[model samples]
Structure formats: structure tokens, C-alpha cells
Target: MQDRTILRTPLCDMLGCELPVLLAGMGGVARWELAAAVAQAGGFAMLGMVREDPALIEAEVTALRAATDRRFAVNLIPAATDPLLLDAQIGRCLDLGVDTFTFFWDVIPAVVRRIKQAGGLVLHQVGSAGAARMAEEAGADVLIAQGVEAGGHVHGRSGAFALAETLLAEAGVPVVVSGGISTGRGLAAALAAGAQGVQCGTAFLATAESFAHDYHKARVVAARGEETVLTDVFVLNWPMGAAVRVIGNSVTQGLGNRLLGHDPARLPREVIAEDGGTALMRFSTDSPMRHTTGNLEAMALYAGQGVGAIRDIVPAAQRLHLMADEAAACLARAAGSRA
Candidate 1:
């Protein structure tokens, strides 16, 4: 096996991780179990706590801490979450001594400032060069350049590589590229393009440790890259114009002409599923989690363009090691080609 240490970058030192890989802080899907497994495997793990209550955040953080002592982050979406709830979430994270945070969607300067004031490290995920600059100025320690190929609540129109190239040139902070990056070849490509690291959601989400429902994981394993669709059909909880990339399902297919320019508020709030006794409505951004039941196919089955690469559901640690080993081999091959 290739020495995986050869694949490490400066980002590894900064994040206290052995691999320059980050599990995308996918809300609901990336919970304590997945995060702990990834962290134990030497990849940076992020607990996806988007719009979740502080109590849940505290409980998840507690579990994560109990599982692993390695550095991890709590992912939050300030723009999408209620201000009071977001505040409480941040507070809970800080109280738990979690110093690293990953913020996605719109970059809220005030929220960034608050984290920075508390001496926390902020990794802001942005879709455009403009947002990159904003996040950098707002005191981000690292910037994650998210591309349109990313699953769930995409913000930028440009592809991953193109946006990454632009951000690498413009941002002072270290940049990590996200979207459609599943395999080691993809990781090697991003590193060759000067990205410090790669953030992956779809790949990790398909793992056995992921909190996503088994049905959702199976769909990702069976899906082709083109089988995924980028649409706003599931915007019940998020703001209007918030686009997401999800595996095509009856909900998205049934949209037909109503794919765009329809008011989500006007749509019927039909309960399609249930998560721990809470109703999961149709058109809601909530993806099917492990505990969720009823009409799983109709819920948002989020997946990246890299879904085609995921053929099986393995443990998160196994998946992370495979990615690292592959990246090392790919880098060696590239270097040998140049020689």
C-alpha cells in the first residue's frame, strides 16, 4: 500500500488531522457516529447541526467528545436557521469547548465575528469568489469552495473546479474544494489544482456509519451521476431560490413544469414521513434519516454528482482510508508521469 502520509498537506497540520479530507457537514445525515468514525480515521469530521436545537447540539457534541478526542467541527447555517436558535447552537458548541465551526450558505458577518471573538476557528463554505472574499474578511480561518455539483442546498452556479481555481487565487485563507468529489482520483485532482483539502458529503453519507436512512444510502449506491437533479422543489424550510442537488425521485420527477417559479408556501403541507415522532412534510429540506419512516422515496434524497462512484456502503473509517490510499497512488502516478 502507498504511504498515506505522502498525501498529507499543510491543512492537515492546521486541522490536527492526518488526512486532508473533511466529511461535509451535511445536516441531519452527518451525526456523532459518522463524525467520530471519520475523526478516528484521521479525517476532519463535522457534526451537521443545521437548524437544530441547542439541546440536540449539546447531546451530539457530548457523544462526539466521548467517542473521540480528535479535533472536529460543528456545522451551522446561520442564514437558514432562526437567529435565536443559531445563537443558542453556537453557545452550546462553545460551552462544550468546540473551537472549530463550519458555516455554510450565506456568510453572516456578525456570526463570524462572534465566533472569532470567542477565539474559535471558522471554516466558511462559499459558492462564489465574492462570498469567499466576504468570508475571508469576516475572519474565516479556512474557506470551502462549494460547487454546483454539491448535494443539498447548493449556493453557486459554477462547477467545483472552476470555483475552486477562482477562490484559490483570490482568498488569503486556505481553500478546500467541495462537490462531486468522492474518490481518491478526485482528491488528487483537487490537490493538483492547489486546493488544500477536499470536503465530501455524498461519499461519507453512503457509509454504514452515516445517520442517513438505509433507503437513501441504497439510492446513492444505485444512482448514476446524471441521475441526480439540481432543483428547488424541496424548499419548504429554506428561503426561496435556495437550490439543492438531490437524487431524482417521484417528488422531483412529478414537478414537471412546476420545477421553477412556484411558491413553496402555497404548496400543501402534506406529511410524507416522520422522524422520531416529528412530521416530515413533502417539499421539506429534511432528508430521510435513520429514524425516519414512511414515504422515504418521496423525501429529499440528497446526493452529489459523485454518487455514481459509490458502489457499496462501508464503514466511515474504511472509506476515509481508501480515499487517502487512492490519493497517494494517484499523486505518485502523476509525479511519475512528469518524471
Candidate 2:
């Protein structure tokens, strides 16, 4: 194998990680087990605790700390979550001594200030250059440029590489590219384009350690890039105009004509699924987790455009190592081409 050092970027030094791969803090799917596995493998990990109760956050953080001493981040969506809950979540993370926090959806300056005031590093995921600028002004330590091809809740309409290029042009801090990146070649491409790192969702979600259900993992493995669709059909728990990229399912397929412009209030309150006694209504933004039970096929099966590249479910550590090795090779080949 080529030297792993070739895959290291300045992001590794800033985040105190060995590789530039960052596990996407995917809500419901990215939990303690997956984060720990990635961190233990020398890549940065993130716990997806968006809008979760503080007790659960404590538990997940405790579990991750127990598994590994490596650095990891907690992801929270300030705009999507209630203000009071967001405060509590941030407070809980700070109390737990977490030094890194990642936010998505909207750039809340006050939240960023609060984290920064507490000496926590902030990584904001932005879909547009305007948002990226706003995040930087809000004191974000790093920026994650998410494109339309990203899975789950997408923020920017621009393609991944285009957004990264735009952000890297003026971003004072490191820029990590997200959306539709699931391979070592993708990582190499991001690095070649001057991105400091890559945030991956679909690739990591399909791993054996992910909290995603087996059915969801199977769908991602069997899916094609074109099989994924971006629609506002699943917007129950989030604000209006919030779009998500998910595998084509019966619910989405049924929206033959009306694929967008869905008003969550107008949607019928039909419980399509449940997790731990919580009723998951139809059109809910919640994805299928390991404990979720119901019409799994009709629920939101989130997957990026890169889902087609994923063929098997392996351990998170194994996946990270493979990607690192492949990226090292790809980088070496690019260097040779220039030589």
C-alpha cells in the first residue's frame, strides 16, 4: 500500500485525525457505533444527534468516548430544531467536554458564537456560497460545501464540485466537499480540486456499523445513481422548502405529478412507521433506523447519487482504510502523470 501520509491534508492536522475522510453526521443513521468505528480507524467521526434529547446525547457521547479517545464531532441542526432544544443540546455537548460541533441547514450566527465562546470548533455545512460566507462570518472553523447530489436533507442546488470550487476560491478556512462522494477517486478529485477533505454519507451509511436498517442498506446497495430523487415529499418534521434526496420508493413513485411544493400541514397524518413507541407519520423526515418498524419500503430511504457505487456492507474501519489506500494510489497516479 502507498504511504497513508499521502492522503493526509491540512484538515488532518486541524481536526487531529490521520485521514481527511469525515463521516457525514447523518441524522438517525450516524450514531455512536459508526462514529467510534471511523474515529478508531484514524478518520474524523461525527455523531448525528440533530434535535435529540440531551440524555441520549450524553449516552452516545459516553459510549463513543468509551470506545475511542480519538476526536469526534456532534452534529446538530439549529434551524430544524426548536430554539430551546437547540440551546439544551449545545449546553449538553459543552458540558460533556466536546470540542467540535457541526451544523447544517441554516447558519445561525448566535449558535456559532456560543460554541466558539465555549472554545469549540465549528464546522458548518452550507449549500451555497452565500451561506458559506455567512458561516465564515459567524466564526466557523471549517466549511462543508454540500451540493445537490448529497443524500438526506440537501441545502444547496449547486453540484458538489462546482460548490467546492466556488467556496475554495474565497474561503479563508478549509473547505470540505460533500454530496455524491463515495469512493477513493472522489476523495482524490476533491483533493485535486483543492478541497481539504470530503464528507461522505451514503458510503458510510451502507457500512456494517451504521444505525440504518438492513432494508435501507440493501436498497442503497442495489440502487443506481439515477434511482435517487430529490423531492420535498418528506418534510413533516422540518421547515418548508426543505428537500431530501432518497432512494425511489412507493411514496415517491406515487407522486407522479406532484413531486414538490408539499405543505406538511396539509399532508394526512397517517402513521406509517414507529420507533421505540414514537409514531412516525407519513411524510415524516425521519429515515429508517435499525429500530424503526413499519412500511420500511415507503419511508424515506436516504441515499446520495453515489449510492450506485456502493456494493457491499463492511465495517466502518475497513471502509475507511480501503478509501484511504485507494485515495493514496489515485493521488500517486496523478502525481506521476504530471511528472
Please report the candidate that would top lDDT against the real structure: 2
The candidate scoring highest on TM-score is: 2
Tens-digit lDDT string for candidate 2 (154-219): 988999999999999999999999999998999999999999999999999999999999999999
Q: Which tens-of-lDDT digit does each residue in 196-279 have in candidate 1?
A: 999999999999999999999999999999999988878898988788999999988898766665578787899989989899
Q: Which residue pairs overlap in candidate 2's backbone?
A: none
- In model 2, which regions exceed 4 Å deviation? none
Worst 10 residues of 2 by lDDT: 1-10
Q: For residue 132, what is the lDDT in candidate 1?
A: 91
Model 1 scores a C-alpha lDDT of 0.92
